[model samples]
Target: MLATPVVFIFGRRFFISAFRQLRHGKAGMDTLVALSTGVAYFYSVAVMLLPTFWAKKGLPGHLYFESAAVVIAFILLGKLLEMRAKGRTAADIKKLMGAQPATATVLVNDQPQIIAVRDIQVGDQLLVKPGEAIAVDGAILSGRPLINESMVTGEAIPSQKESGDSVYAGTINENTAFTMRADKVGRNTVMASIIRLVREAQGSKAPIEQLVDKIAARFVAGVLCIALLTFFIWWAFGGPAELSRGIIAVVTVLVIACPCALGLATPAALMVGIGRGATMGILIKDAAHLQKLAGVTDIVLDKTGTLTLGKPVVQEGLWLDDDRDINAGYPKSAARLLAAIERSSQHPLAEAITSYAISVYGKDYSKNNDIDFDHNANAASYINSVFLPGLGVEATLGNDVYYVGNARLMAEKNIVVNAGSEKDVSPEKPVDFLTPMRHDLTAITSFLQAHTTHTIVYFAQKSAKDNRGTLLSVMALADILKPDALLTLQRLGHQGIGLHMLTGDNEAAAALVASQTGINRYLAGQLPADKLAYIKTLQTQGKSVAMIGDGINDSAALAQADISIAMSKGSHVAMDVAGMTIVGDQLSKIADGILLSRLTGKTIRENLFWAFFYNLIGIPIAAGILYPFTGFMLNPMIAGAAMALSSICVLAASLRLRYRKLK
Candidate 1:
């Protein structure tokens, strides 16, 4: 609706200034656009000096550019909203750091007084109350409590802690009060380190950013050269009535032919995707990872951190002596002997050992001569009479001295570990045993296939009183599966994806977790080289695999996968190899990332089609499409309108990507 070339010139000037400042300025995109808009507003006046202006209307005449004005306004407004939306993601990380109390209750001069977190010096004593954020990273000097370490693990389900246990800043004190010696203060805290990571990650550009810059440099020069040729050709072949023909064609080409939209497409989508992901509890390290993840078909998962809660739980326990029915030549009392060590154990694995015993034997365990250990004491519970002088818990029930702990415990006393019953299961040693319920992970694979758990070692030794000794039940335990493991596996399965579990955990636990989550392929008790080899095998078979891990041992495999996804809670080595990082450790977000990347790729193609089509079709016609027909020359005003509209269409096409529907 604007007045002729006046409206068109204004739009042309707008694109020129925006393109120029963005190309040359040492400012941000928002600042560049602002400065360019100002420069173009004045530059449009230059259009008046040409013959198109001198013959009729004066130099002050408007360019009459309605569409360009609309597009520029719309793009600027879209950019502002996008920036604000992304800013919320950064605020979340900062807000987490902000939650640490402004003031801390410190023991200064032996008196409790509130002071700033910065003022608390090292070696300062702090009394943490029940349900308080730990002011400083320190070791607990005294007391025991169930601390909720949701700050670190993101799992707030009350984990117990005692004296000598190390605690960090920002963890809520869930149980009794404790005295802690401040070891780290101020910037040395865990919270401080995480804040620093977020800052470093936010400011970093992806490898693709440099590629975009190179492409733009070549593209801009080429576009300008083509525009120059188009103008000269028209003047030579078709002839111009006035010198203004050169000016109109030159301005139209300069304003309309820009590669800015293409340059911004990938980065804009990346910025939005990563920022949006972080808000939903995921963090991608770079934009290239989005491109990488789109191609991944299979995912390799680590057993403990990725699939299970990583806590050892009690599943079942069997004592040989308690059973009334005999199995083969074994005694009916085999079940009771297993409970002897299981009952004395406090380990998470021991819970399963005793749990199995209680289910069969019933809960009537009473120690007539018991060692009364209280919540106040850091003590190992025992029924004193059953233990021998050196060998662990020696019960005379069947008159056998059964030992538990490690091979070192057995070697220390020079007790001969029975080879037939020993299951030596380390990736380094890899010993096999014939004993039932051996903790040695050597049989984790077979046990996993049968859906049994690892974490318990079973053995019995000869006693002088009972020289005709028997192999008694020594131990049984459980390792809890990772949290939300089943859900994660199910989500992957729903997408028709296959998952492989690569782990150093014993086969029994690894297989059990895999089965529980419906994972059919599990490689347990694997070395780092083994994991890497497996990844290579998948690669050789043309599988696009994604490896997810959270440990130093997983570095090689993580790097070997097509896309390496690192958990935010994982070790440094794992994070280093990972192409993408999940900031808040939500596995489900990975699925969302894949969907967004494909949609964005389709959008760029569609936009480029519109951009290329407008220029390719219109410029030839404006040059002289029907010179042999009616002999009516193409109007400079119409050419100007078509050129301006070309830029408008490209801008509109690119902006339409914002409305892409994501699954």
Candidate 2:
């Protein structure tokens, strides 16, 4: 028939591949189709050529060429659909690989020259012009520009980078040209690492898949044995008509017991689930993590960048000397001096002070003689500027030395603040002229206590002739929480997931953020080791822990948790180690991801159950076991169509995951 050529054209590869597998003694799902269809087609040709011989045995002498062709056609159709779905599942890796630039412009003998990205090496100086993607991870040698790192960090806002700050490949340089010294290239780049992670994850077999593979391996052999047994039973136990019935029973068992549905049970569901997560802005690094996410019982969140906006702003300030009212901003001259010192530092706290100072007093005080503030342009005039790590800034402003830091820095410098006309000063430092009257100490304490949740930065000054400094003023800075943080936490709690906040911030600030976000428990002032230890303890208690954070300090904890989540705007190290990255930095996506995981898991279990359940009941019926009681037998042609229907049903069940509501 004309249909034979069409079937052969599409199904030739399946037959050849299956034959090769059988000859090598490694039978797969293809082998079952090849054996059943090959027998049916060739036997039908024999019956058409020699009808007298089949008539002698009282056989039907009917040709079943169409049955064989239809089976191959149905199978080929299923394969085409499965292949398309598999490609969509791995599209996330393609999106990530596309981000890397193909070429880079490097400085050759101080002149810009274009070269392939692979040709660029470490220590090479590259130029990233405005709107151009960075070619490699490097440090800026010169030029200050705003770089859009959303490609890597998932943060929508462009971050400003000055000279000596680090820039990564795939990030766009905005509105400026910058020269950078490449530190990593090619496979060593962060983008390359992300691509590799996604590929490995997609290729990795989930734990359930391993179980299915084990069952499938033995399934084909069992089907062959059942078909042989069905043939022998019909010939040995039945009357003269059993000869033709025996032949039909053999083909029926093999056709009906096709392992296609069983083999596709896990992978089909996994492909759809992983692909859906990518589209929803949740990048699942691997299928293993997808399986792990649904089981997470406890979620640990970092405070700084995860719950609250990382940007700190000045809330309030008060001068130690009552010369200016506390409700008003710092003294104009002191604010100018503080801004100048802060402008020289790159700390977030320092940036807050500088912004506050510029708003309270103009950027340049000389523009208006009415105010005694100094210009920020003279910020570089200070000498011996040292940025004490985790403390504050120390710089010289004219003939006097100034210190802008926290209470701990003031104590370390031995700056006395007590209730006396002449405070008890350290003998090693000159502090005879300074005094902390009872009223002034009471006022400072009251103001600081009132803003217990704010980060208070002290501004102190001393004459160059003296080693000690007098406390001039204090500024309170606070980082506000994200708008959706409260609702996201409440949703997670309602789902029975325990919420715990782990932060490096002080207890008071952490407590305020926790209360506002509706999180009932937290561990403040926790280091990376402390977080890792807590996750380990939770795991020991049979709780699956998920840690969400966005800094280098969080990388270790992320690696330790059952599921690690990172914000889009968080540190590269944290995202790299995390199993899931929320592209929009929304906490609600975590809940959505968990919901999708549970739904996908349920679908896979249903697929697997139907696959096994169908074979368990279908195989015996096809073998003619019901013929003795009901006199009903599964025809070879009907068995082929039923087998194809089972596979289509499995595919349809898996596709349902694609439409499940994430919200």
Candidate 3:
């Protein structure tokens, strides 16, 4: 009776919460705890106060006040341990938050002023000193800094940054000081987006957890019914001390059955797995998407931006007929015209051509040229410039039309490409007029095409009489492969995943990348629709497809795939449509993410199994099933300890995922 007051006071929360849940026609873990301890406490009080009343019924008046107190103490201790373990699961979020400094040095009116990070505004020029964290996302205006991007990229090597390069928040300026124009401040920074994504992913419930919740909802009520049935069986069948045995059985059954473990099985594993992924620069947007990543069978990769570096550079340029009268001042005039036409388009190849022209003919080539071409002074000199999606660009310059694109685009406009000595050579047909020039162009075209894997671009001028343009020059451009492309593909292939490459590039370039990467199957000349259709076809074959891309054309295909991955350096449209984003634009993270998903899935299954198995064996023994043979009956205090240990076991299983290697 002395221990009753202390037990009631310390465990009041359980009783109060159980009462509230009962009022709403629901029950939970609190309900079972309250019923067991409440029954034991009140029954002991009855025995202590009414000794004579129990003597008449041939029963000993024993007080169980100590048992009730010890049970509450054991449960509280278990809860404290579980809380500490759960805190460790979110340590990654804390580490990421710690990466941001509280204050930043801003260049206010040509002088450095220290200010709070939250006070930073867009377009503000912030100065970052050596060995300091960047204030926010911005582009470098001056000074090249070697930045340590491991906070965002998970790489140890510092990246070399120059003028016009972007720097993100939380990155360390390892080498030199630089001034930057802040483009994204506060919540608009990339680190802020990564934090938001990681939080959402950790908080989300997997599909399996939804099923567990439904089972756990009815679990408490079912355990209550079983406890009541155990009481009746003991009261009727117990040979001696039936009342004592019956009350003991009721307390033990209610205390030993644990619903907490069942509730925590899936969510605990998901939290630890997602938190670990963030540390490796893998931002998982949702738990459901991470679950889907494990079962991906075939992975469709985009040629540019995903596997190869998206930047294309000019390698070689050749003039078709240098000795012809019409080709006088050929190279210079052609370079200026090509620059003017390509400057109007937004394609990467167009940018490469424009840069090449500016480098060869100087930025202000019109000042020294005799031709009437000045792109800056007379912007309308190149008029009606149209960008054909899969073809090239078409523009008109001073009554002479020009075509700059693939061979197919040239053929569509009836332009004659006189390459090689054969009659039906290559995709473009040769004209019979310039025989000697054709032989020279043929040798050059054959050498360029056969020697290098670079993409070929043709420059042609239209004729007024035949309406067929003459091929003026050919330029070869190349997009280099990523450093980790081959290794990443090899790892994914070893894991039994089928790899396929899709691109809008021509057959020669596509074949070369495929062969170099050891990919067996590839398709070239694939437009946006063609890529989308390929993904759908793979899905129709009962194959789970994962698409990795980094362009606006890849948006539809990214959305259509079962699992879509995007490079952080890619276009916004592709990233917005993708389910997962690989930071640092590293292809190897794709394999790491898949391996993490498999580990998380395995952990969740083990947790669920242990939860169900514990309850199946524990509840019966607590109800005096063993007393019929060896005379063993579980004490209420021991039952409480066992229940607490079950939840701890589940948490420990989940925490194991944090330490597992993701290679």
* Backbone clash numbers for all candidates listed: 38, 1, 1
Model 3, residue 275: displacement in angstroms? Answer: 1.7
**Candidate 1 vs candidate 3, lDDT winner:** 3
Leading candidate by TM-score: 2
Better of 1 and 2 by lDDT: 2
Please write out the lDDT profile of model 2 over residues 126-185, one tens digit for every residue.
Answer: 988878999888899998777776445433335668789988887888666879999999
Candidate 1 per-residue C-alpha lDDT over 1-663 given as tens digits, one digit per residue, 9 for 90 to 100: 343344345334444654565688422333222332332333345554454754563333445233234334544444443344232235535555664767777777778888888899999888888778888889888877556564554331335576888887877786467888899998888666545544443454544546655655554555556656866776776575434544444544444443334434554555555555566555665456665576678989887666655455545323333222434434423334445555764332345555565455555344523212222121223322243211234433232345544333444433432333434522344222333333423333344334335544544554554322233443444556555556767877887778898877657666677777788998876755677789889889899888888764565566567677887776654565466666666666667667666665565566556655665665455444444576544544465456455545545554554565666
For model 2, what is the error of residue 139's alpha carbon versus the real structure, in angstroms, after optimal superposition? 26
- Alpha-carbon lDDT of model 3: 0.73
Error of 1 at 428 (Å): 49
- Give the number of the best model, judged by lDDT: 2
Q: Which stretches of candidate 3 lie over 4 Å from their true place?
A: 1-206, 210-225, 238-252, 315-350, 354-435, 438-442, 451-455, 458-473, 478-480, 501-542, 551-561, 571-577, 626-638
TM-score (all chains, Cα) for each model: 0.53, 0.63, 0.54
Candidate 2, residue 79: how far the Cα is off, in Å: 9.3
Better of 1 and 3 by TM-score: 3
